[model samples]
Target: MKGKLLIFLIILILTTVPAIGADISGNVISESGKLAGLIVDLSKINGTESDENSITGVTYDFIPVASTVTGYEGEFVFENLDNGEYRVNVTYEGVTSGENIRLQDDTFVEFNLSGTIDGYVFKYNSTIDGVPVYLYDFYGIPAGNTTSGNNGTYSFGNIAAGKNYFVSAVYAEVSYTNNVTAPASSDFIVYDTTDKSDNIGVTIDHIVLSKDANSILVYEYIQFINNGDRVFFSPERTWLAIPTPRDISNFQTDVMECCLEREEDTAWIDPMIPLMPGETYSTEISYRFNPTSEPVFFNRITMYNTDYISILSEKINGLGLESTFSESNIVNVNDKEFEVLDFMNIPAGMTPDVKITGFVPSKNTGSDLGILLPLLLLLSAGALSYPFVRKKMLLKKKKVFTVKYNPDNPSGENGVPSGGNSEITALGINAENHTSGKTVEEMSFHELLAERNNLFESIMGLENEFNSGNVSEQEYMAQKKERRDSAVLVIKQLKDTATNLDLTQPVPELEEVIRHIDDIDILEKLFEREEKGMDRNEVKELIEDRIEDIERSE
Candidate 1:
């Protein structure tokens, strides 16, 4: 009896346990024909009964039951899977792909992975890592997204090939987009936002509003400064929003030194050029709007925080209007008091409203031809006399030579003198002995100045050639070394002459030359490695090091 009871208990335990069901197998291959050697997981999905308090149309994922690695042939298999629906997932190279599988019986599954899109995000010619990059299909559906790497490289996989898609990079609440097509392997693209505020610095120079006979003309001068170490290329391709206060017919968009586009009340400017570091881009825009016979209110919308703002009207008294600005000063212009607004340091992203109230001549008002005749005569006379006045002023001013022993002007003129329209002539040398040829010790002050100027000119020419890509780095360095040697010799001679003459304090003229020589010496050392030819990354690193050195010295 005991043996039979024990056997019955064992049979009952065996019957209660469930049995394994179907086996599922599949092979995963990328569109580029790359085999996937990754983990493939399977999760069993179970249906739940509807409850009164439960929410509807919600998906719940259960834990994965079994997982396996793909073989060399990109093949994966799961044995003893239950006869129910399961979620199959494959993860490879940090990318995940999945599908649904119903294992009613032993089945074979095949997955052809989609293509990939990969590229870099750049700002001011440098990579911006850790930025979020998104991918969307032609229908604007989010396909995939990824974050950039330290090198600013990002990739999105498992996207269908031969499809149109758009890529967007987001940084600092600004986005840049580009459209691309997925190739068999991958679609490579770049999204650059160098013209954005964070990458390019901006300042509002001034906003001037003047009265026109029939309407009011508004003028805005804004400056865009490039503070990045490298040049900000693609100026005209960069888009900046400018909101206009007037209607389409009343507004006029003028892009100076950049590209401009107007749509509705907003204007877009793309300064289509490479904006080098320390370079400034000035943009001017103007518009006109008609006024009413009754008191009319005019508002000049401040798109960006402006450093200086002003409003002037020649017919202020006639218009019977008072102009006011936030934190501004009053100044007299052509016998008329105009509001001048100046902000010493306006924080970025601040937009202040400017208000003006005046009674303008409406369509019902009669023409004041009697009052206008004298005004027209005065304007014509001023225009005709401008040239004579300018000439007299020019004649009275002394000729100023810019080629003093100073730093590089950054204007690409090198040491060449500018602005003075006077003829170039040889001046007297400051030496006690004015001989055509003399030793360094016997050289006069004027001779030293001339020699230093020539050296700087040569250096500047070499740099210009390099910048224009007309001269190779090797050639630039070779010529630079020769010029540097000559400059150093000239500087030493000047110092000795000062000491021999027993002069006290620093030499006023040679001070700038000495300082420039020191800077050149440091630059030579920094660029020594570049003589062998370095890539952009290496050059960027060198620049960073130089910046660090300068900061440390300060």
Candidate 2:
């Protein structure tokens, strides 16, 4: 009797349990594949008995403990539930038109949920991770979430086949670029696998919106495809500089009703709705971000308002909301992903700090290497390696005595060399090419002044002889003129030397009849005494005598 009772108990437990904890993957579709991310409200569904207290027209999934499933890429599933017969009413947020329909049971069923679909949850203008995704029915409420991976993919597990729901992809604690106030939109919707759908099959496509994303002012879409697949996954991601913050102010969506309220367009409604597979639609949420005047602040990431709505003119059901997406992804500055802990608020003054480094290029870091290395290296290597060969190359290759200096060639000593052919070769010592340039070692200013004194002396002698009447008037004038010219030339040279020595300082005047061979005027005036006895030689002698006297005094 004990054995029999035990067997009976085991059978009863087996028979009574509707879902064996095995994921019964179901699709919401018309003729397409899977329908993901649409909220099926328990109370409000069109064509299903929702106004009445009973959901009898549609399938009821009475799990020992009832649970909800979400869709991603047009796929959904309910896991870890002991299934039983429970009434389910499918309501997509704004989508209601579907061809195929399914009757509800506890097990996996493949029937028309509406239009078929494959869906994904892309962060609306974000590269952050670990954002929570939500789904909604015709009325606004939470549905399911897609756990986004590093690759920005999330999945909705088992779903009620005919349930129609709308999707809202949310990224928590995501950043907004500074000073940019525009709506960046990403989509999570129900999709169908058919020729008429936008996205289908395992590969679901989505546009990732970021802080710098410039979305069109009109609308942005989330596509769905119902391709008859089960629990297809997509990834999601978020980003933060600090530990994730709980400030939800940065993440808010405003809904505005269009003037045309004829259909599933209404106020206080999330535009996401009953997404058929292979069908694409977009809803506008006022995504204007208000910035703070804080410097180097942080963005606190979190999921908010999981429920949204889309209504009609009088009162019609379209889609709903859900939150089943996994909070596991987050994005950083490098766009690298890390596992997120939770949706919490991060504080300000937490941006990554990068030092403003003034790297004066070091010799090792490729700075002055261009100016210093190669020449030094070449010179050093030349001196160190093969010094003998280098010397040989210098002596032999530099043309030691290019033939021999031909003395027959007219030496340009007193006369300047005038023609290009004059220089065939150099004798004694030729100037060596110097990178530093040709510079005379030493030339004293005093030595140069001494040379000028001698010249002035000769001019003074000529002037003296002329003044003494030793030469005829014409002879005196001519002699004085020559001496004057000589004195002028010498004085000009002195002026040039003085200028080179920067001797332009103020000098006191001398009074005592000092004979100065300053210029032609000085010499001529001294000799123009109206005398014919004075000659050029006698005047020159006088100048020489005056010069000695002047030098002795100095």
Look at candidate 2 and tell me the lDDT of residue 179: 12
For each candidate in turn, give its C-alpha RMSD to the true structure in angstroms.
26.9, 48.9
Q: Output the lDDT of residue 331, model 1.
A: 36
Candidate 1 residue lDDT tens string, 237-276: 6666666654323444434544677776567787654455
Badly placed stretches (over 4 Å) of model 1 are 1-195, 228-230, 248-258, 291-295, 315-328, 332-337, 347-349, 361-554
Candidate No. with top TM-score: 1
TM-score of each: 0.30, 0.16
Q: How many steric overlaps are in each model, in order?
A: 4, 144
- State the displacement of the C-alpha of residue 59, model 2, in Å, after optimal TM-score superposition: 20
Residues 1-554, model 2: lDDT tens digits: 99999999999999998753544445566334555666542211222112211111122222233335456654455554343222344445433321121224445534354333233344333333454554433222233444455645544433333444444454322211111011112334222212222122211111111121211011111122333322122222111011122211222122233311221111122222222333322322212112222221223211111011111010011111111111222212112222221111111111111111111212221111122222222222211111111111111112111122345544233222222222223222221211212111232333333333333333343344456666577976785576567546545654544333211110100111213333333433444421121112333344455455444434
In candidate 1, where is summed lDDT lowest over 10 consecutive residues? 387-396
Question: Each prediction's Cα lDDT score?
Answer: 0.51, 0.29
